[model samples]
Target: MNKKQKKVLTRIIIASVLMIILVLLPLEDYPLVRFILFMVPYFTVGYDILLKAFKGIKNKQVFDENFLMAIATVGAIALGEYTEGVAVMLFYQIGELFQSYAVGKSRRNISQLMDIRPDFANVMVDGVLEQVDPDDVEIGSEIVVQPGEKIPIDGVVIDGNATLDTAALTGESVPRTAKIGDEVISGCINMSGVLTIRTTKEFGESTVSKILDLVENASSKKSKPENFISKFARIYTPVVCYSALALAVIPPVVRLIMGIDPLWTQWVYRALTFLVISCPCALVISIPLTFFAGIGGASRAGVLVKGSNYLDALSRSKIVVMDKTGTLTKGVFEVTKVQAVDISEEELLEMTAMAEAFSNHPISRSLKEAYGKPIDTSLVSDVEEISGHGVKANVSGKVVQVGNEKLMNSIGVQVEDIVEPGTVIHVAIDGKYHGYILISDMLKEHSKEAIIGLKRAGISKTVMLTGDSKKVADLVAADLGLDEVCAELLPGDKVSKVEELLATKTDKEQLIFVGDGINDAPVLSRADIGVAMGALGSDAAIEAADVVLMDDDPSSIVKAIGISKKCMRIVYENIYFAIGIKVACLILGAVGIANMWIAIFADVGVMVLAVLNAIRALSVKKYK
Candidate 1:
C-alpha cells in the first residue's frame, strides 16, 4: 500500500475504536456528551472528504459526488442520527481503500511488462570501453553487452556469439543463437556470452524504446464501456443527492402540517443510507481497471494493444481480412524445381546465380542459395534488370537471361508450358531457351491452426487480401480454408476494399484487418481494428497498427481476440453487478426498508467484489 492509503487506514481505525468506546459509555443519559463523541468520529473519519467537498465548491465544481456525500452525511449528524453519519463515512473510506489497492495491483502488472528498457550502454571509443547513456549510443558505434544485460540498440554482431532470451519481447521461451554477421534486436537479454555489436539504429529508434512508448500511452485511448461510466457518473450523482434531500425534508414537513408527530430523525437516517448506497465507487473503479488488466495481459503475450477501444472492437470483429505474404505465408522463397533442357541442373543453377547475384529480389536470393556459395560478380558483364520482369547479363562471355515468362516472350524465346503450383522463372543461354525454374513461398506453421481458432472465437468470415497473383492467392486461401480471397491489390485498392467491407457491417459487428507490409499501412489505418503481424522488425507496421503481434505468429491473433472477448465479458459483469446492487439499496433506503449496515454493503462490499472481478482479465487461461 502507498503512504496515503496507510494514513487513511490508520485514521479510520483510530476513529472507529473511539466511536465504539463512546457508544458503550453512559452517553445516552447525556445527549450533549453523546453528540460530541459522535462528532469526534465523524470529523476524524470524514474530514478529508469534507475538505475536498469545500475545495471543489470553491473551484466551481460543486456538483461533484464528494460534495453530495459530505452534505448528506453531515445533515444526518445534525438531526441526531449520529451512528449513521459515522458509519457512512467509515464505509466510504473502506471503498476508497479497495480502489487504491486495485490501482496499485494494475500498476505492478504494467510495470513488469514494460521493464524492457535498459538504463546504460558500454560504448567503445578510441580502443577503450566507456559507459554512456543509451541515448548517447550512436549508429555505427560498437557496443558491448555483458551477461544478464539488455541489448541497448538494434545492431549486427561483429565479434562474439550468444544465446539471447527474447521472452520479454516475443513471449516465446526459445533462446535464439546469434553469431558474427547475424542481426540482434534490442530488448533481448544476452544470457551467457560477451558480445560486441555494431549498432545499426539509435536508442530512440530501438525496439525497446518503441515498445515502452506504446504501452505507456495505451491508456489514453478510452474504451466504450469506460466512456459510458464517465457519462453515467456525471448525470447520476447530483440527481440522487437531491432526491435524498427531498426524502429527508418533504415527509417531516408534511407530517407537522397535518397535525401528526414529525419523525424527522428516522427520515434523516434513511437519507444518510441513501447517500451511502449511491456512491459511484464500483462503476468508476472497475471499468478502467478491466481495460488496464486486459492491456497488461496482452503485453505479457507479446501483443501490444495501443488502446482499450481497440480491444472492445476486436472482441466484436465479425469479418477478419488478412494479408497473404508475411502474414499467412512464410514469406521466404525456395527453389522447388529446376527444369533444364540443354544444360544440366547444376550448370543451369550456377549460370543463373552468377547473372542474378546483383538482384535483391526474393527469387534471386533463392537462386543464389541453390548454388550454396557466393558467386564471383566480376565474371558478370552487361548486367541489366528489367523492371517488373527479370535480369539479363553476360556470364563468362555468354549472354544469359533469368526472368519470368514475360521476359522470355519479350526476348523472343519460346518455352514449353509447365503446369506447376508455383512461380516460374524462365532462363536462356547463348540465344536459346534453356528451361524454367519453379519456386514457391511456403505457408507459416500455425496458419491453419490460427484459422481454426478464429472460427472457434466466433469470427464469421475469414478473408485474404494480397498483392500477389490471383493463382497464388487462391491456392493459399484454399489451402487455409478461408472464406474469401482478394488478390493483386495495391495500397489504395486495399483501403477501398476495407471501406466496402465496412459498409456491410452492422452496428454490432466489427471488421479487423491484419497485415505486415509497409504497403499495407493504408489498409491497417482504414480498418476498424488494425493488427500488425511480424511487427518486431518492421517500423512502418508498428507505427500504422493499433495492435502488434511481436512474434510474427498467426496464432497470436487468436490469443489476442480471445483475450479481448474475455475482458469485455468482465467489464459487463462488473457493470451489471455494481448497478444492480446500487439500485436495490437506493430503493430500500428511500422507503426506510434498509439501514446503515445494508447501505455499507451496497457501497463498500460491492465495490470490492467488482474490483476483484476486474482483475480476472489478467489471467492467461482466459485465452487458452
Candidate 2:
C-alpha cells in the first residue's frame, strides 16, 4: 500500500477501536458526554469526506457521492443516532481503502507490462562503449546490447547472434533467434549473447514509443455504457437528494394534517437512511475499473486494444474477414519450382533474379534469395513495372520479363498453362517463351487452428481476401477451411468487398477486418473493427488498426475476443447487481422498513463486492 492508503487504514483502525469502546460503555445517563465521545470517531474517519463534500458545494457541484454521504451521516448525528453515524463513515472508509488497494494493484500490473521502455543505449564512440540516452542515438549508429539488456532502438543485427526474450512485447515465452542481417525491434531483452546493431529508427518512432502512446491515450476514449453511467450519475445524484428531502418533510406534514402525531424524528431518520442508500458509488467506480483492467489484461497477453469501445465492439463481432497474405499466411514467398526450356536453369534463374532485383516486393526478395548470390547491378537496366503483371528489365543485353502469364501475353509470347496451386511467375527472354518459376507462400503455424478457434469461440463466418490468383487463393481457402474466398483483388476491391459484407450483416453484429497493417489502412478504417496481425514494429499498422497483435499468430485474435467478452460480462454483472441492490434498499429505506445499518450495506457493501468482481479482469490466463 502507498502512504495515503496506509494513513487511511490507520484512521479506520483508530476510529473502529473508538466505536467499539463507546458501544461497550454504559453512558446512557450521561447523554452530553456520550455525544461528545462519539463525535471523535465520527469526525476522525469522515473528515476527508466532509471536506470534499464542502469543496463540492463551494465549487457548485453539490450532488456527488461525498455530499450524499456527508448529509446522511451529519443528519443522523443531528437526530442523536451517534453510534450509527460513526459506524457508517467508518465502514465507508474501509471500503474506500479496499478500492484504493485494488486500483494500486491494477496500476502495478499495467506498469510491469510497460516496463520495456529502455533507459539508455550503448553507443560505439571512438572505439569505446559510451552509454547515452536512447533519444540521443541517431539512425545508422552502431549500438551494442549486452546480455540482460534491452535493445534500445529498432535496428538490424550486424555482429552477434542472441536469444531475445520478446515476452514483454508478445506475451509468448519462446525466445526469438536474432542473427546477423536480421531486423530486431526495440523493447526485446537480449538474453544470451552480446550483439551490435545498426539503428534503423529513432527512439520516438520505435515500437516501444508507439505502444506506450496507445496505452496512455486509451482511457480518454470511454465505452458507451461508461458514458451512460456518467450521465446517469449526474442526474441521479440530484434526483435522489430531492427525493430524500421530500421523504423527510411530506410524511410528517400529512400526519399533522390527519390529526395525529407528526412523527418528525422518525420520518427524518428514514430520509437520512434513504440518502445513504441512494449514493451511486458502485456504478461510478466499478464500471471504469473493469475496462481499465481489461485493457491491462489484454496487453499482458500481447494484444493491444486502442480503447474500451473497441473492446465492446469485439465482443459482438460475428463476421471475420482476413487478408490472405501476411495475415493468415507467412507473408514470405519462396521459389518452389524452376523450369527452363531454351537456356539452362542457372542462366534462366540468374537472368530473372537480376531483372527482379531492383524491386522491393516480397516476390523479388524471394527470387533474389533463391539466387544465393549478389547481382552486378550494372548488368540490369531499363527496369519497367507493368501495373498488375510484372517487371521487364534489360538483363545482360537481352530483354527479359519476369511476371505472370498476362505479362507474357502482353509481350505476344504464348506459353503453356501449368496447373500449379502456387503462384506461377513466367519468364521470357528476347520476346520468346522460355519457362516459369512457381513460387508459393506458406501458411502460418496457427492459421488453421485460428480458424477453428474462431468457430469454437462463436464466430459465424470466416472469409479470406487476397490479391493472389483464384487457383492459389482456392487452395489456401480449402486447406484452411474458410467459408468464403475473394481473390485477385486490388486494394480498392478489398474495401468494396468489406463494404458489401458490412451491408449484408445485421446492425447488431460487428464485422472485423484483419490485415497486415502495412498496406491495408483504407480497409482497416472502413471495417467495424480493424485488427493488425504481426504488427510488432510496423508504424502504419499500429496507427491504422483498432487491435494489434504483437506476434505473427492468428490465434491471438480468438484470445482477444475471449477477453473482451469476459470483460463485458463482468461490466453488466456489476451494473445490474449494484443498481438492483441500491434501488431495492432505497424503496425499503423510504418506507421506514430499513435503518442506517442496512443503508451502510447498500452503499459500502455493494461497492466492495462490485470492485472485487471488477478485479477479475486482470487474470485472463484461463481464457484459452
Candidate 3:
C-alpha cells in the first residue's frame, strides 16, 4: 500500500476498535452518551467523505455517491440509529480502501515498464565518451553503449557486437545477437560487449518514446460499458434520491389521509436503507478497473492495446485479415533452388549477382548472398533496370538479363514453364533462354500455431491477403491452414478487399487486420481493429493500428485476442453481478425487509467482490 493508503487503513482499524469498545460499554441507559460515542468512530472514518459531500453540494454537483452516502448516514443518526449509521460509514471506508489498493496494484504493474526510459546516452565527444540526457542526443551522432546500458536511440551498429535483452521492448527472454551493420532500436539492454551505434533516429522519435506515449495515454479512451455506467450513475443518483424522499414522505401522508396511525420513523428508516443500497459504487469502479487490468496484462505479454475500446472490439472479432509478408512469412528472401541451362549453377548466380550488385533490393541481396563471392563491378557495364520487369546489363562483353517472365518476354526469351510455389527469377544471355533461380520467403516460427490458436480463441475465419503470386500465396495458406487467400493484390486493392470482408461480417462481429509494412498502412486504418507487428513494423503501420504486437510473433496476436476476451468477460460479469444484487437489495430495502446493515453489504460487499474479480484480468501468463 502507498503511504496514503496505509494511513487510511490505520484510520479504519482505529474506527473499528472504537466501535467495538463503545458497543461493550453500557451507553444504552444514556441516549446522548451513546450517540456521542458512536459519533467518535463515525467522524473518524468518515471525515473526508463528509467534506467531499459538502464540497460537491457547494459546487452544485449534488447527485453523486458521496452526497447519497452523506444523506443516508446523517438521516440514520437523526432517527436515533447511531450505531447502524456509524457501521455503514465504517464498512464503506473499508470498500474504498480495497479499491484504492487494487488501483495501485494495477498501476504498479504498468509502471514497471517505466524502467525502459533511458537515463543517459553516452556520446563520443572530442575523443572522450560523455554522458548526456537521451533527449539531447542528435541524429547521426555516434553513441557508445556499455555491456549493462540501454541503447539510447534507434541506430545501426557501426562497430562491435553484443547480445541484447529485448524483454523490456518485446517481453521475450531470449537475447538477440546484434552485430556490425545491424539496426538496433532504443530500450534494449546490451547484455555483453561494448558497441558504437550511428543514430538513425532522434531520441524523441525513437521506439521507446512511441511505446511510452501509447501506454500512458491509453485510459483516455474508455469502453462502451464504462461510458454507459458513467451516464447511468449521473441519471440514477438524483432520481433515486428523489424516490427515497417520496418513500419517506408520501407513504406517511397517505397513512394520515386514511385515518391510520402514521409510523413516520418506520417509513423513514426504509428510505435511508434505500439510499444506502443505491450508491452505484460497484458498477462505477469495477468496469474501468477490469479494462485497465486487461491492458496491463496484454503489455506483460508483449501486446500493446491503444485503449479499452479496441480491447472490447477485439473480444467480438470473428474475422482476421492478415498480410502475407512480414505478418506470417519472415519477409526475408532466400535463394532456395537454381536450375542453369547448359551453364553451371555457380556461373549463372555469379553473373546475375554481379549484374544486380549495385541494387539494394531483397532479391538482389539474395542473389549476392547465394553467389557467396565478391562481385567485380568493373567487369559489368551499361546497366539498365526495367520497371515491373527486370534488369539488363553487359557482363564480360555478354548481355545478361535477370527478371520475371515479363522481362523474359520483353527480351524475346521463351523460358520453359515452371510450376513452383516460390518466386522464379528468369535468366537470359544474348537473347537465348537460360535457367531460373527460385527464391521464397520462409514462414516465421509459430506462424501455423498462431492460426490454430486463433480458431481455438473463437475467431471464425482467418484470411491471407498478399501481393505475392497465387501459387506462393496458396502454398503459405495451405501450410498455415488459413480459411481463404487473396493473391497478387496491390496495396489499394488490399484495402478494397478488406472493405469487402468488412461487409461480410455482422455489426456485432468485428474484423481485425494485422500487418507490418508501410504498404499495409491504408488497410490497417480501414479495418475495425488494426494489429501491427511492432518489432519489425513500419511506423505508418504501427500508428494506424489499434493494437501493436511488440515481439513480432504471430502468437502474440492470439494472446492479444485472448486477453481481450478475458477482460470483456470480466467487465460484463461485474456489470451483471453488481446490478443484479443491487436491484434485488434495493427492492427488499424499500419494502422494509432489509436493514441498514443489509444495505451496507449490498453496497460495500458487492464492490469488494467485483474488484477482486476485475483484478483477475491482469493474469495472462498462464493463458494462451
Best-performing candidate as measured by lDDT:
2
Measured with C-alpha atoms, the lDDT of residue 606 in candidate 2 is 99
* lDDT per model vs. reference: 0.88, 0.93, 0.90
Model 2 lDDT tens row, 418-469: 8776879999999887888988898899899999989987899999999988
Provide the TM-score for each candidate, comma-separated. Answer: 0.91, 0.90, 0.93
Ordered by lDDT, highest first, the candidates read: 2, 3, 1
- Which residue pairs does candidate 3 place in steric collision? none
Regions of model 1 farther than 4 Å from truth: 125-127, 337-360, 373-402, 406-420, 426-436, 622-624
Show where candidate 2 strays beyond 4 Å. Answer: 336-418, 425-437, 622-624
Tens-digit lDDT track for model 3 on 364-410? 99999999997899999999988899899999999999999989988
In candidate 2, list every pair of residues with a backbone clash: none
